[model samples]
Target: MSDATSPVPAAAPVARKVTSIGLGLLAVGGALSAWAFFDEDLRTRFGFGYMVGFTFAWAIVLGSLFFVALQHATASVWSVVLRRVAEMLASPMLILAVLYIPLLLVALLHPDSTIFPWRNPTSEMAEHAVHVKGSYLNETGFLVRTALFFSIWIFFTWFFVRGSLNQDGGRRADITERLRKFSGPFIILFAFTATFASFDWLMSLEPNWFSTIYGVYVFGGITLSALAAITLALSALKRSGLIAPELIRKDHLYSLGGLLFAFTCFWGYIAFSQYMLIWYANMPEETIYYTKRLSNGWAGVTVALAFVRFVIPFLFLLSRQVKTDERKLGMISIFILFGQLFDLYWLVMPNSFGEAGPGFGIPELGPVLFFCGVLLVAYGRFVRRHPVVAMGDPHFEASRGFRLH
Candidate 1:
């Protein structure tokens, strides 16, 4: 696999299968979302429909990009066998760009009372001192900022993925070096964009409420989710019998598991720190965010995060055996992915409906399915164009002989 002259098998058929499934899911999910839009009750209950769509779409993009960064940061070989898998994750950014249509519609049509309360100039909510303090929370500013965000994301997705595809055409070592060079700057840009993106999309739900660490909190979740996604993708490829079992060793699993553990801790720390600061300060403005979640049906979600997101995974992944076993790691990945979704739901839903309970009804399921479909199709297309591994990569031999201990 390391030989530059080695023949690389074409990935067209597999790519097509992946694309078909992705498109099929998108159609089904899109239909559900369409129905939710027309169904007044469902739409009202899932009041954060637009926000959910935006967040889910962006989450996948950020998650995939974060995986790329981690791969570079650790210089791990196990992931070399799966680097393409991680790179393909970014393919959804294009589809997500289109998904923003509905969000743009919501902002344009309901400038005042929609998700961002600050949009409504005459509303009493807008008169509050906190809302007035932020000049960027307005309707026009929101649209402009969103457009800029998507543009930057789409550009990086194209550049990075394009370079990988070019490598399949027998590019030199310099091509890989170019990617590494771009990686540093890309990571920095990703950190800033991801933070502000969370603030703009999720935090603005309650214009008066703000947290300095909220961006880092969201990044932690995104990173964890991306790792889960990578594990799942690798498992799927193995199941398909396309990936060589020997290529992915227990050491790789352990490394990925360790990353999951580290981020799990980081997410908990951020969540607790934010909560504690607000609790100690007892400021009405800051405390109001927690107040809404603690009351009504949102309280259940809070408890779910405490146990599902942190405690359970924390204990389960603590073992070296569990971390190194692919099947066990894959199962834990699935759990973490679902937990992250629930975490996002807990964050956005409370503000959408003050006392309304959180349910995985059409409003929630529709966007999730739709975006998921898009992700599948895009990733499939990417995989089809490139070799599953970097055959010409200088480190390919090192990756092949990678060991755990």
Candidate 2:
């Protein structure tokens, strides 16, 4: 469609430069990853580190996909201008699918890998607590579930993204009707897939410790972080003169900032709800999860998460001036993204590092850099070729002047 031959705005050359820089970073990250793969000592560390990086990127991708679907499902006119960027952000699903192969291979071949305790249960796992759960925690089940999860995610992501791109060229009003028709059903599917995927990829890390609300907790971080990513990207495009200020007005940015504030509150509520219920019940099964995190220097990371995820964004965005100011909002969005990385780190690292606490050495940095490259390259290449805004959308004109009442 338009992605192939559209005459992009003045941003093409800049997007090309970004692609080049991403390639360089990918090369560096790939080299370090190879070293870590071959080195026996760093192999397990590499696996865990890669999970951190993968989840961080995965949240953004899934979040973007959700945002685009939500707007279509709600027929939200105010967010129409922002939807294209969300689509671009979600474009890396296949890349993530490919990256997951190594982790899957480890589960299948290297059963002794420490990254997934379920794959190689210890003697302690013989206890009834962990043993009983072994029915769903088996190797074959994990592989089958992983395949199912990716299939659902890839199909839906491709459907929404491709439909949007086709609309940009075909200029068919019927396309919008078809997308809206499917949006509701897709969301229902999204909820189940996202929840079970979190359990499979992350919560199962400890095997014995679990939370009924863990999926909701992960969902909060995913949407909040993805919104922040979209805001920052749109801000960058505006600053570079690729998108005119009037097209994506200050009021529109304020609307985005408002959503950021709302989801921050949602995240705070879920984080508190999960922790409060577990603390109140004080069961050995549930308490074990928080106990490890609250001890051995992990407490500091938890505190930082509280501030970044909730308190800081909650207070700062309350100001009308701040919400509308590109510079101010951009800063908070950057912090939120870093907070998302730390949040995922908190979830994934404590399982491996344990009493030693969090580690941020080369093993960790390598994968972070690699995924960062993947995001930049994926975004830059897509925006360079495609129309940056959904100009053919029926509501394009209406969204240009949309404002919060």
Candidate 3:
């Protein structure tokens, strides 16, 4: 018998059919995206959209890794039931690393590529500050540093995920201890990579503008969106009778709700602080970012982002009962996931399409749909390769029967 009140059963592998559906979607979405790239001007827009798309996907996967790492480092019993889902979430990283190539090609081969301002210097790029940034912002350094980030991400993702999967077959206690020991320092490594990666990829889009808390802002979105995605997946698994009853407890949902609530606040705080600091300083470079976003039809997106990402989630999740209700949680999860997309659009599209405003059609939505297909297929196959629940975890029962008190 397991240690906690409920005896948890090992979860069965996900169905192969689910993986097939995901693959089908990927193929269809990929075809549409390729077709869109034929128009020269549309191709440029696609290039920007491509970066945003992968970055959106990366944020969720890396965010899950952060959650899993944090839980392991703290020896958190209640979250053990959800750990496997989080692991599966991180499984898409290798494929994501593959998707990053186009962005690199845009930076390297296309002389007219303006997705990254520093990569192709214009008259604006010819300014004194651009020259000052020459050493750190060169094409060679950008590519090399990006490679380094991927090296760290792919290697560690394999290490952490492989350790968890190995536990399923062996049920080794030492394995758990090793993961615990590794996670503490790994969290620090995650922070550094996340910060610099944001700097290199997103902030560099507008070379002159910068925010000290930009990485944290990105972190908040990643964490919140990852949790939302997990909750939605958990709900789907439950509805299909795949998850064990004991694994879906009020306390566990409540914990997720608490986290969802907590991060919602953290995101707001970080956003307000970053905006306020920049507004107070009144520096030209710092002010430019908010100015573009606040004007040009983007201001509406900014408002909607606040409401969807923070206000609605925070308000809905405040009540204890709602978190425990799976259906309600699923709705909130979808909302937050959508919010992450809106927030990224607000941050990025304004730079390229500010004059034209937020335009949506097949052109805008194509790459995003394609990447989503990739995420689903990658995640489904990963879960199919192993048990959906971490039966080897010593804390499995405690997690299954976890209570908030």
Can you write out model 1's per-residue Cα lDDT over 268-317, one digit (the tens) per residue?
A: 89999999999999999899989888888788789888888999999999
Error of 1 at 260 (Å): 0.9
Q: Tell how far residue 167 is off in model 2, in angstroms.
A: 1.5
- Alpha carbon deviation, residue 286, candidate 2 (Å): 1.1
Candidate closer to the true structure by lDDT (higher is better), 1 or 3: 3
Q: What TM-score does structure 3 among the candidates reach?
A: 0.94
**Candidate 2 root-mean-square deviation in Å:** 2.0
Model 1 compared with the native: what TM-score? 0.91
Q: Each candidate: what lDDT?
A: 0.76, 0.85, 0.81
Counted clashes in each candidate structure? 0, 0, 0
Sort the candidates on lDDT, descending order: 2, 3, 1
> For model 2, how many clashes?
0
Name the runs in model 3 displaced over 4 angstroms: 1-14
Locate the minimum summed-lDDT window of 10 residues in model 3: 1-10
Instruction: Give the Cα-based TM-score of candidate 2 against the true structure.
Output: 0.96
| Model 2, residue pairs in steric clash | none
